[model samples]
Target: MSTLQDSGEKPSIYLHRLQVALSVTIKRGGISPEKADQHLLKQFCRGCWDNSLIADLQLEQKKMNPPSFAELLLLLRTEEDKCTAKATRMKQHLGASKQRVLSHSQRAWMSSESEPDVETTETTPSQEQRKSSSAISQPRTTTSKTQRGKPKPWYCFTCGEDGHIASACDNEPNSVLVTTKRKQLKEKQRLWESQNPSADQSPHMAFIQTNGL
Candidate 1:
């Protein structure tokens, strides 16, 4: 069932196929009938690719005691029926509105010679649009997790380029400015490293390790 793709199949038909598969699995001694409900529920959910459908079942899925396979199928069938009915009503409303417009246009054309006021008490397009759009089901809103975007790039102070520091930069290193800076750094380290060891102070960890510990 996890391999089953939606392929534009209706929920009812999908559930039917799932039911048949579960039955076959049970008859083949693949799964015990006692645990078939749980297996069936999982396989059904795995087969559903629609986020909205999954969202609709989240409440049931999160329950302390999850709904049975039969209950899930029944709920899915009800949802499918509701969606079909709403779609049918929306089509009927749109067709009626179109017919009304065509009828009005024909009448106006017939009386084109004599101009007369045509009263329009028809609902506005916005109203009809809202009415038609209301048919779509709204999925449950889930809070999104905090996502870290591409990590802030490294800033190079030497060349002011991103993604690298001065040490890692691959630009020309023989420049006078770079040579002078490196000389100054090495001189400072040499002076520090050459200082005599104080009697009261402890030796450096590296010096101790280099010696007999």
Candidate 2:
């Protein structure tokens, strides 16, 4: 006697009870006759209950005029599109404002640090003036003291004597010149040794050989 609109039991709860009764009726058909007849009564009771519940739900839905599945889906899609458009426009506006602010800041900085322009002439000078300027800019030449004194004698490998081969320049200190000249000689010696490994042995080997000798 439990109707779908019974205040004590909710419609969903009543439906659940009905489904259980139908299951029990189907299960009892394989059992004794008395149990089968009792299960058949339960089945009829469950069916009537389910039909009444469904009818009540349909009547409630008609009163409310709820949206169809397709209409609900389209509404959701329209709302999503509107949200996306609004977000895009907001982003664009923010970007434009940022660019404007940056431009204005740059312009203000430029105005504060503005520099004045310098002027230059394009006229040319005369050739004589140019020559004189070039002459002034040229490097000065150094002259040796050979003309003021007697000509110094040159030294030769075959002979050595005063006022002849090596004595005329005996007053000059040659050690400084020798030291300055050693850089080129050292470079040549290194190149020769690299090209001819057995030509000039290392200083250690030379020392050992000389000591033995």
Candidate 3:
């Protein structure tokens, strides 16, 4: 609702959009026709930038209620038309008044300035005619002091070596030295499985059960 606004939209345009939104909500079975009408009217009023028009409609609504939503829209539309017409008339009048004053002032100024320079005189527009023609127009290039560092060297984590990556390293992982117990566990499991020919347990399950896993 905070985002809902008429902007320059006519009441009918705004109402059309509002009806589209309300139709979906109304079909979901909570809001009735009368409640929806109230919401539409309230939100339309809230969305309108013309406070005077909304106030007038609200006043007339209190004095004599509209028979339907269409009737209410008719009332609002009538008020909007009247306000628009009045504003147009006021703007025209103001513009005409300003025009009259401007013309009178212009006449006085022109009469005073007419003695100084004649229109028949020709003056060279040296400054306006002077334009620059570039031999080579290129995009600007800038070098910053912050870009002074040399690129760091590449190193392999596999064998603690430089100049090559880990993926290309030929040596086996040095981590195998730390996991010697894992190798022992695998060897013992293989031996036990060979000894017990009728084992039906899951992989490593027999090893874990027989040992202190």
Q: Rank the candidates by lDDT, best first.
A: 1, 3, 2
Stretches of candidate 2 exceeding 4 Å from the true structure? 1-63, 96-213
Model 3 agreement with the true structure over 12-119: per-residue lDDT tens digits:
445545544555556677577557666666666666555555665563364333334456555756765665565455436654334334333222212221111111
* Colliding residue pairs in candidate 3: none
What tens digits encode model 1's per-residue C-alpha lDDT throughout 2-111? 54634555554555455556656676888887776676666666776555666776833644455655466567777766655654554366554443454433222122
For each of the candidates, the C-alpha root-mean-square deviation to the true structure, in angstroms, is: 28.0, 50.0, 32.7
Model 3 misplaced stretches (Cα beyond 4 Å): 1-3, 59-67, 96-213
Using all chains and alpha carbons, the TM-scores for the candidates as numbered come to: 0.40, 0.17, 0.38
Q: How close is candidate 3 to the true structure, as a TM-score?
A: 0.38
Q: Which candidate has the highest TM-score of all?
A: 1
**lDDT score for candidate 2 against the true structure:** 0.34
Residue 55 C-alpha lDDT in model 3: 69
**What's the alpha carbon RMSD for model 3?**
32.7
Residue 20 in model 1: lDDT: 53
